[model samples]
Target: MNVRWHNGPMRLLAPLRSGATYRGWVWLILGGALMMPFMLVGAIVYNWFHPEAGFEGALHPAVFAAVIPLTAAVSLLLPDREVERTAARRLLGAEFASPADDGTWNSRWRTGCWFTLHAVVGGALSGVTLGLVPFCAYLLIQGARAVLDMAPTGAYVGWLPDWGLLTGPGLLLALVYLVAAAAAGMRALAPGLLGQGAADRLAASRAETARLAARNRIARELHDSVGHALSVVVVQSEAASRLIEADPVFAARAMAAVGETARGALAELDAVIGALREDRDDARGPQKDLADLASLAAESGVEVDLRVTGDLASVGRLTSREAYRIVQEALTNVLRHADEPRASVLVDAGEEVAVAVASPAARRPRPRPGGRGLIGIAERAAVLGGTAEADWTAPTAAAPGTWTVRVALPKGTA
Candidate 1:
């Protein structure tokens, strides 16, 4: 604990600054020692004198504790604030190029603890060991200083600080007192600063996990239930269209299939909604992947052209899921924003599977799904370590002016 305590200021003052080392910590503690004596002494003495001064002492320690760390803090804010920057960066997996508003406590509280640790240890050493040096030497040198200071004129001879074993030992004892005080003071001031940061990181993790689970559950339930029902309903409807002229009995069967499919979909949706009654942490969504997309498009009356090169069984869930989303989003874009009522989709799954959607441009469709689709595309690409691009293109004679959406997913989501 003591070593850990000292390291905080070490990190702040003279931390390893990237390729360089910062030895500013010694300066931070020593300088703080020299400057804070007045405030610390006054606070200590006042507390010793008055009962009401307890709160004053409490606030005073932060002020005193802040000084050394503050100096170190300035060094960090300097053109070379790189060491502490790297430490926090690694802790949070943050970017140095971007602003680090997150490591506030990492820099502040940890640093303050270090300064206090140094002061306490240094003061004790000064009192117990260094203090004895002067005391031991005092029998020889104690009275010598006054004698040396004695002037030819008796004016200076009358008044002088005692240069004796008495004063040396007293100063040493005072140093010891200050060290103990500093340690206790730091404990009072710096606890939970790091804990708070850790809590924030944990909260973010929990939140992200919860969000992911919720979204996955919704998606899986929709596909397994609503999506399957839609598939059955569409098939039955098509059968009815063909058979209505030939046989009313077969037509009735087709219409009944629609009702049963829709009911089944609703039942699945309800089952998912019921799962929310369990602990949120217990929620689990069955994994869905790219193998399911072709069926999804077909069920929705959208034509798809899928081409696979490399085996996808080697591909993991995260990559496969992201690729599925890319296809889903692309098709959504074509349905809602494409210039033509019909669109073409081609997915190539080699080392990379590229999904591109193409539609004629002259048939102006309603302006739609700009913000949400783009954000979802970017998010999917980011999650999969892939990328997506969309553009409006000038048409060739064979394929007149058209709009195209393309997404590329790598085998490895690095």
Candidate 2:
């Protein structure tokens, strides 16, 4: 029971035993020693201006305030500022995820304030720590006197109180209090002066948001391009296998189509991977726009009728690229799930660039949880101030029931 009780309490003091705590104590003492000369200089200058007043004269509080700014300015403007900042983080164990630099006006002012406070408090604590040495020596002498049965005379020990409540236990308690208070004061001040500023945090968050968006776009592109290629290869390979015994020429053409589709897929996949490699070097490659839709439709291994009604030169790059992906994903869905492997693509690039893909509906579409293809199409359109919709249309006298995916995208860079 005793061992278990002591274990919990011992963990609380673990920080005090670390090397960082020892380094902090060293920096505290050194900062105090360095600031003492500035204090002496301020005192000398004050005395020079007031010839009549000696050291006995009481100094005004404003005089001390004036000296503080002077020393603080010197500390902040000099290259020692970096040393102090690094020491505060590496030695004093400042707890901030991302600390801002001391370059801006506000950061400089805060840094000056930190230096001023540290110098004053550390200097006072240094004196108290040094003073304990003499206090211990005096107690030792008094103990020796008691052992020898010789009373302490006025010559060796100057005017002092008897060793009792006033000098013995009371002095030890005061020492403990002083040390604990100084440690607590430093621990409280480090975070406020050393942590990141508001602007730095905002900039970091924006960068993270941009990174996530880039990764999401890459995933959508992979899905549309690679998924379409796989569906074509599967359909063509099965058709070739069934016809190889009946028609040799038709089977050869099917095999050739599969090879062509595989090569196109490899090229698109390589482009995506190359873009990822470029990201590391801080460069971005071009995206597949609506102009590439012709080649995509040709390689889909199905009957496709594509038509464009308006001028596509005025469409924005993002809207054009997203529109192409929407068409590609729509055709991929039809090939994978529909019975008739025939589709039509109509692109009307006017004030708003609109794209539509329709095919004969054989089965009702079932919604699946966490489907990225259709959801990606919707998200891409939404990002460009556009909208995407998928539905089943009633059969007309000229055509059977149809499944359609339609998207409308704004033109400008809004």
Candidate 3:
């Protein structure tokens, strides 16, 4: 009997040791509390219409049952799924892909179902707790009196027969398990009701893809425009510093070139930033194209032997713009990594537009494989259904091997 008694209480009170049990109780209590206002309004409305029923009659079980459907309908129509999802996540430990309102019929009905289930189950459990808890307290007191060998007062005993002392503990244990099961059911249903549907998932995926593409485009713009400008500024400033004392006129020209390059870079930087900010009305000048290659070469701070074989006006705007960026990035690499800053640029516009930039290979260590400039060139070419290649040429008797970047883009009729 002693062994059985000890193990019995341990098993009965085990759920009290778990924090989840307390959280579950709180969740149910909240659901019950939320239902009260709806119940009150329903009772008031029913009493207002039927004066003979009076307040007491209006507060009937039927009125409370009617509020369950009212709650479900309200939950379905409201655009507050985010609020409900957050509550479930924090209280019930539900996992949802996103808490944003999906605005779909599928999600709406699920939320409505969950809301109705919560109200009904919570109301039932709460009603049971109010009666069962106090009765259990009375039973505990009576059991204590019996253990002490004290005679039960008539008021305390009333019309109740003496059951076993374990009755109170057993009832409390059953209540705990009941509450736990209800909580588990609610939690299991939360994700399906509150989580993203297939359409929501697809939209999220597309948004992510667009975000990444925008970021890459911005990176390429900064790399091709600002990167090339910085490279030119570095070379021109250095030349000015070396020639300032010996050849003042040439030094002045170099300094002037630096200023022009800086201003142009600042403009391009503004344009890219404006684009990022989505400032549609900001009239940043149009992007450079193959027609602007001559001006680009002139400001590159390097001697570029530029050759054009066909009319650039015939090239579509997209192809021309991308071709310009590819050449600009190639020239920028030449200035940054080549042994000699001088390079040869070739642009041939035909059924396909071809661009090539060649410079002496660097005597120093080459840049790490897949540099951003090279990658940008390749990405641009691929976007137009074209191809790009960067490789080292065989050394000749007159010159060491040259690093060459070549790109070809389709000449779309734009």
Candidate 4:
């Protein structure tokens, strides 16, 4: 490995001051601690079977070997990989793509392997840390006595050969480096064993795409159904208020139309919400198709000259529904933004279904850019392998001219 150090001694000793180093140490320490109960039980059982071997036998390699499989089994079977991942992310600083737990055999096996590695390595490092500190202290004391020509105080120091004063500091420095290396190794291993794999990432991506698609579908439904109803209501209510006294019969008819439009909008809204709740598979009633275009124009509360040609019944259900929505959105745009609330609609069902709506453009102000209704029309057509375009026609400096929307969709088999 090519290592880069910027500040020499300070850079070399940076891990000692870092909070991540201590947190990593705590994570390893917890792993060793978790294995203690199993090891203790194994030791107790070993002592019971062989009383002649005594307590010293409990510390034998056999006791540790038995506990390893037990810890591995527990880690594998427990449905707590999420918990492990959380701890690893917070304490050991492992970066995971997703925190969701995918209960797969491969995931469990990886968790088991990680558990084994953690327990074994942690226990060994803990033992080394415990032994090295006091040993380094002893070496420091003994080296100081030799350098000062002072007598050694402890009997344990009498057997060792005299060494220079630098031995203690050298060994202490080695211990620091050892701890830093162990922490680095644990961090490096965590992401692979505990983090999300290829399959998990792919699954997450597919789910996100599905969610976005559903949301877009709901938006289009609301914009078409509710928007058209509200536009009709606004126009009828305004007309009813104006003619209520002079033309009682006509005003009553307009008010009735307003009431009918509101009820229809409410029903459509309920269906949309019911489908969102997944209360029933058929919560949403049968979708509107191209056959409903005449009724839509009649109830639009505007003078709409609608023309239809060719065989409408031959259009497929999917294409018909999209074509209907495209027309509905176009009429809604005319009702809301046109200077005159009158439009001409044409539906040509030939090799491909063609729909067009034209109306006098608003003269006082132009429609804002990036309106959702127009975008939705284009999207609906594009989804059915079709095209949609809207622009001003016959414009001049004095007049804004006619605003027209045109859409064409492939006529699939019924």
Candidate 5:
């Protein structure tokens, strides 16, 4: 282990370096100001028990001295501790390990215990500092007079420390250490009184996880819904351009389909954005399911063969939504990346719903390891206790090399 020079006198001088001394001064002054009312009340109570006063309820002087300061100190404990904790953070640079809130009365009572200890220690330090002032003043006068002569009527000098050459330097050093120790003592209790425990940390972690999950869900919704819409708009616009002069009526129909698709896409986008607003739970997702496959097939610019083999209505809402998204994403991929725009979708609904989309692969590129599309497909399936797979295979003479995405989700998941 390596030892550093700062651990030497720097440890003693730590308060001065970090401005803790200044903070301690502020804390002391603030605490004293707040304690004044309590102290005055205690004084009045003590005097109310005085012999000079004609009141029948009189207490002994010894009891008054013992009880008065303790009563004042206890009365101001909570607020005083809060002041000290703030000073530790601002002035002494205390770093908290975890969060603490407006805690319970039990925690406040614990803080009061800490404050009582502080009062006792701090009161003694204040008394020492006060006593030093008179001593220092007396020493200065004795040093200046130079002659150890008695007063005109006196035979001996008053009770003063035997003057030595190092006395001044020694007294100054003691004062410095007294202030430093007081500041250190206050900072030492900060973590015990102000830090959070294990339960608080766990709650904070859970909240953070919930927030991240909601953000991811919104991102996935936008990507699946809006991306599919944009892909439809692109393909329909291209098809319309090729057919407009040769078949005006069919071209006009395609353009109209584009407008409808755009409107639905905008609504889906609005729904997703609205979910992020204050009334999130009231915001509904875009209504979609395996039954929409026929309309989805119609919107595609190229040929689409969509087949359904099982009872679609038996599928619950969440599974149907996932199935719709899977096909939408697959068709979007076909339009965006495939050399040929034609594709096939198969829905086999049973105890588990299986969905598949196949299209000719793009000319040059293949799926990479971390494409968001494939990752999202896998995530959707996994969320419903299912699985997704994507692959590209060698070309067949009958058609071409194809890219396929498949997902299987358990039935009745909502």
Candidate 6:
């Protein structure tokens, strides 16, 4: 372990937990500054009681001191409760090592209790050094009385060891405090941290499993179920248009049926999106696959010419989603920047999936230093475990020169 060396006395001092929350600071300050008077008053009252030894005879304010910790304890305690832990799990997007289906309300409650105890102990220890010192009050009085020889503290100058008698105890308390604060800080942030180490693997698994399930579900909804209905509606609409030229009654009926069909599909799409938005504790995932790309393209009102020659089902969801994202971002760029009326998206699936989005020449192209857009494309591809290229000019004169983004990712990104 490489211990950092700081020059001077700061090395002897304890470090505060760097990640303390806004609420944590509020509790600390209020407990220290606002509650500080009690410690001063207790030292004063204790001296009055002891009379002879004066200020040194003072002890801590046990009552007020107890409340300072107790209040902080209660606040920190509630945040780590079973209910709160569940919320934390969802918010932080981390998984704890408990049996998913086996977890009970009591299980989280028990964890919360442990967390609260540790947090309160830590918070209270921190409050002690900051609040109980009475160092600030002593300084103000001493500074005010420094010019007067008759000052009560003037005759008290004597030989002392190592920055006075407070060093050992003060340092010991500080060490205890730092340990407590670190523990509490870890407890507060642990769920998020625990999963970070293995997030990529977890995500790959979830995406593979979730995507297959989502794709199958969406396919069933879109293909045999919704697709068949839409086909019938289209057929009926075309038939109605012909009927209108023949019989007025039949034309009106067909157009009404087409409208009803479209309205029903829209409602069903909303229901699907809603189900996905639900908070599920056991949310493995609803996976996305390349199979959904066709529907996605259609839904976006972007004209697509899809030609898939190989088994797309063999590829994993993680790879598929990354490919999808590449396509999505490319299309978004065209829509936002290209201002082109039409764009072409091409997908070549084999051992790897290659996705390319080509946009028409910008009427007044945005100033790009390296023949542009290529750098951003390459960076995004690298993140998704792939390579990319962009060109402002076409490879052959047969094809019009335009901006193009092409990316390739591994097929087994599970």
Which of the numbered candidates is closest to the native, going by highest TM-score? Answer: 2
In the range 203-238, model 1's lDDT, one tens digit per residue, is 667889998867765664455345546655766688
Q: What lDDT does the true structure give each of the candidates? A: 0.54, 0.73, 0.83, 0.81, 0.69, 0.53
Determine which window of 10 residues in candidate 4 has minimal summed lDDT.
Answer: 156-165
- Give the root-mean-square deviation of each candidate in angstroms: 17.5, 4.4, 5.9, 5.8, 5.9, 15.0
The lDDT leader among the candidates is: 3
Question: lDDT per residue, candidate 4, 1-414, as tens digits?
Answer: 134444676787788788887787777777777767777888888888887877754467788788888888877886666776787789878776543565787788887788877787776666566677787778778878887888877756653414635766677677666666776787787777877766777888999999888889888899899989999999999999999999999999999999989998998898889867866756567888999988888888878999999999999989998998888888888888888889999999999999989898654335587679888998998888899998777768886678889999999879
- Tens digits of per-residue lDDT, candidate 2, 158-262, equal 333234224544565565555555655676777666556777788788988987898887788788888888989999899999999999898898889899989
Give candidate 6's TM-score.
Answer: 0.34
**Which scores greater on lDDT, model 2 or model 4?**
4
Order candidates by TM-score, high to low.
Answer: 2, 3, 4, 5, 1, 6
On residues 153-197, what C-alpha lDDT tens digit does candidate 3 reach at each position?
A: 545574231442677777888899998878878888887777876
TM-score of each candidate structure, all chains considered together: 0.41, 0.80, 0.78, 0.76, 0.74, 0.34
Of 2 and 6, the candidate ranking higher by lDDT: 2
Question: Candidate 6 — worst ten consecutive residues by lDDT sum?
Answer: 155-164
- What pairs collide in candidate 6? 210-286, 210-287, 211-287, 211-288
In terms of lDDT, model 6 sits at 0.53
58-97 per-residue lDDT for model 5 (tens digits): 3233433454457444644454445546655776566665
Q: Which candidate, 2 or 3, has the higher TM-score?
A: 2
- Point out where model 3 deviates above 4 Å: 1-20, 30-83, 93-102, 150-165, 362-365, 398-400
Which TM-score value belongs to model 5? 0.74
Candidate 1 colliding pairs, count: 4
Listed per model in order, the count of residue pairs whose N, CA or C atoms clash below 3 Å is 4, 0, 0, 0, 0, 4
- Model 6, position 2, has a per-residue lDDT of 38
